[model samples]
Target: MFQSILSNLAIILLGHLLMSTLITYRERFSKHLLYIYTVVLFSTVSITMLYLPISFGDYRLDLSLIPLIFLALFRGWKITVPVLFIVSAWHFFMGSDETLSSIVFVLILPTIFTLLLYERKIPTNINLKILFIITACWIISDLPIILFIPNGMEIFKNTFLLRYISFLSVASIYCAFILIGYKNDRLKQRLEFLASHDPLTNLLNRNKFIEIVEVKMKESDTNHYIALLDIDHFKQLNDTHGHLTGDSVLKEISSIFNKYESDNLKVARYGGEEFIIYLKTVYDKQAVRTLEHIQNEIRTTPFHSNNGGSLHVTVSIGLAKFESGSRLYDVIHQADNHLYSAKNENRDQLVVSFD
Candidate 1:
């Protein structure tokens, strides 16, 4: 019994290691990973069925609990139920009538219950509910064998109770590891996002924006436009109202920028009251039209503050097209110069320094 338990545990650990490695590799080769996992799991189930068998008195046990539990937790019920049925049918064909009947009851009923639990989306803390249901099924399935044993109560105490306790402990530990891994992955993703994004407007921050622009500049043809836009008299707005109102104005304008974004364009919050738009397309006229539309949108939209007051805001936009083999900073400097010119000249219009 101890050897059987150890063998089952070793098989489970080996399968887990293989699955973890495959899942890690799948992150790099996302297209074929699911196919690989399906094949591996199916093969594992087949091989395990051929090798392991449990014994109690004159009754034999189908040592399929590990695979059934794995399928229940990972693949859920849809695939598990069919797999359980197939394995039970195979056991029946192998001429273990008593074991086959017990296996059928154990595998099929627990799987159905598992499916219902999953459908209900029960809390993860309800492992005891799962344990109770599985224990109930196992007890009912093993009752005939228990009654036939020489010392039935002693056999139940030594075998079924001990095995069930061990299974419960191991299963709970397995679930804990899975939950921890998921939480760790989530934390890593959030940290990566926070590193590359601005907290204020939830836009790409200045540093990431520059890195993206540099990469794009290397691949850019001679016609892509880079525009720098600044909110006019933004400091005065913050001074007149509060910083809270200024934040509302920034968020309002950020929403306007989001509306104008497209696959060919990238938008970033360059700094306080300043934003950048990188347009990849060669149409300078369309770029001008788009910027004009954004300016018009901001001009017409009355930004409401938390204090039940509304304020109007305008932006000065400067557009410069990248010439072939031009430095990115030089193009940005020219755009900035044009933006200052717009602030000096029209305060609410776009100035183009198309090359």
Candidate 2:
């Protein structure tokens, strides 16, 4: 009995590990592919549990409800139904005369009851919720034995009744704790990402950009440049068109800059109607060519308005080189000075030098 308990635990822990790993790296998969992998995983775990039931006098108790409750709670009907079908079909193949009824009591009914708990249809404390669901599923699990086996009631009352709860309750609570840990871990990752990224453009925010620049300044062996850009007559354009159109213009402009992003180049929406581009290069000429491409692309690409008409816009750019050992803000200040010059003198110009 101890060995059987150990074997069941090993299987359950392995299944949890696979699920946690998938959730951690879920972004690497397409949504459909992730769904397929999840179905296969839970179905495999449930089927494996059926084959490893811990034996009593006349009945074997498999930890089927653990996986069923988890799948129904987390995944919903779409995923649970398919998993149930697969598990039931495999149970039928195991050649029980009571297979059809076992499906009703063991897997399906418990899953539905657990899912109702998931929906929070009734208000209950968390402990009570867990207790109620586990107790109900436990009762359902005993139904097949009581109905189909001879002297089953005496066997169940004497051997299986008390021991089953201790195992299932401990295992269920342990699994719940693991899932709660996974949820918190994923939440922390999401918060970190949201902190570093701009909600509007999904680009690196100003502070994150600054952090990266500081790291790059310390490590970069080649020359570095900052290209500060502002949309020409942006306020007037916003006043002429609506804010929605203005938002569209900003989104389109951000999309244009996103195309030029690479290992050596990064871009950020610095503030309203302004952007910053950071570049690392061996040659000053290479830096200027990249800036020119970006400027020309923004100038020529037609932006869309809410009224379905197209609008043309241009960016005034100020390029400044980062001299070794100079403060980052000092370089940014020079770029701003040049930007002021570009804005004053012309609507669309790339100012690349002190001259």
Candidate 3:
């Protein structure tokens, strides 16, 4: 019996590891692919539990509810509902009528009930809640057994200690996996944040900005335009006021850009003193008007310096509207050329080309 428990535990731990890995990369796959993988995983764990049981007289106990509960708690009803049907149906079809009915009812019915508990209140004190729910579900599942089996109450009273131990063992494994899944989620979030945002300004960095724009260009049905804006005399500002002031100016401009940003517009810090914006505007007049608004906003805003002084700045914008079959680099180059035209013509002007 001890060896059988150990073997079952080993299988459950392996399943948990796979599940943790999948949770880490859950956003990487399509919903349909993830659904298939989750169903397959739960089915394997269920079959292993069904086949391998700790036997006492005519009764066989398997720790199958552990993973089933985990499925509902973490993956939710979208995946868990289908998994419940598959695992329960498989057990009901394959084993002896008495054994399978007992297993299926005990495993499936109580797990669904526990899912209701979880859905209503996702407690902050999760570990204690897990133990409580699993124990409660186990006892609740056995109510039918107590009523139906011959001398059922007496049998339950005798085997209460064994049942507690089995449930505790499974609950411990579930707790471990839950912790691992949360840790992986936190780590993935941190990684994604660092990958997509600029450390200095908290704006989308150049690479991520370009990647998003290219994706939008591919997916968009409407016309989009890319505009590059450069701060006038930024190097001179850094030389005169120091890099600290330059950093402050960048942060100030990023805040303004973010304030004016909308669903149809994206603002990114392209590089030093250069910002990139993408607008989902089909008409040249709309794009020009939006750029003009931003240009005026920056021109009028004052940047406060550390030495109780105020600095005024102007920006030069170069805009290029995307054409059919035009690549991102090509559009950007056109914008860059127009930017130089604005800089050459005057430091505080806008140069745009719809052609």
Candidate 4:
């Protein structure tokens, strides 16, 4: 009995490890690839249960249902549906007389309930709620073994209690470990986001934007255009309306910048009231058109002030083109020069230069 318990514990540990591995690779996998991994995981757990189950008088217990239940709760139908097919096929091939019954009572019913429960908006304490639901479903699934199988009541009274205890013990420990892992993963992602993004505007910060621009310049064989944009008379606006208004205006501008962001276009907050844009393409005309669009949008939009008034502002833009082998500093310097020219010549329009 002790050896049986240890083996089952080992299986649970192995399942947990496999789940952790899958979580790490999830970002790299598409929906189909993730489904394939889920199928493999389900197959392994099923095989482990069939070959090395804890024996009772007329029933066997294994942690095979652990992965199935957890994945169904956490991953939704995209993963759970495939796993259900694989496990059902395996059970059918095993030739157990109870195969049909198990499919309905054991797997199908619980999965249906789990899916239904998962769609509801969980208000709070989500992890605790899920754990409770899983435990309830697990105990509910074990009812047939306790009531219907020959001498099941006697067997459960004598031994299945121990099996239940073992199962819950392993589950509690493993779920706690996974909870910690979830917390760590969330924290890591939060830190990465904070590092690259402005907290106020949620736009790319200067350092990360420059880093990306440098890499793109080095790798792309085509021409790239860098534009420097400055909000005209920003300090005067801030002085007139206060810094709160200044912040609101900046956020509004950032939203407009973000609206145009795409694979070939990147926008970032260069500094206070200033932004930098990187546009990648072979045609300078396309880049100029995009710049014109951005300028027109900003020029027409009136920033709403906190004191119930519309404040109109305009921006000066300087555009410069760079190709492979051009220095990043030189490109930016030229753009800055053009931006200064725009500000000096006229406050509301763009200045573009190629050669």
lDDT of 1 at 119: 37
TM-score of each: 0.71, 0.57, 0.75, 0.84
Candidate 1, residues 262-341: lDDT per residue as tens digits? Answer: 76778899889999888887677888888888889999999986689888888999998888777878888999999989
lDDT comparison, 1 vs 4, better candidate: 4
lDDT of 2: 0.81
Q: Which pairs in model 3 have colliding backbones? A: none
Query: What are the runs in model 3 whose C-alpha is more than 4 Å off?
Result: 20-29, 95-105, 119-124, 214-222, 230-265, 272-274, 289-316, 323-330, 333-351
Clash count in backbone of candidate 1: 0
Write the number of the candidate with greater TM-score, choosing between 1 and 4: 4
lDDT scores for all predictions? 0.71, 0.81, 0.83, 0.79
Q: Which candidate is the best by TM-score?
A: 4
User: Per-residue lDDT of 1-355 in model 2, one digit per residue for the tens?
Assistant: 6667677777777888898788888899999999999899989988887777777644577776678776776567888888888888888888477788888888888888877667523234655666667777878877877787788787777876555764575467555767586568868888998999887787888899888888888756798888899999999899999888888888899898889999789888899889888899999999989989989998899899999999999999999999867788888888888888889887698887633
Better of 1 and 2 by lDDT: 2
> Candidate 4 has which clashing residue pairs, if any?
none
Residue 167 Cα positional deviation in candidate 2, in Å, after optimal superposition: 13
Worst 10 residues of 1 by lDDT: 54-63
Per-prediction CA RMSD (Å): 5.3, 9.7, 4.7, 3.4
> Residue 61 in candidate 2 has what lDDT?
76
Query: Judged by lDDT, which candidate is best?
Result: 3
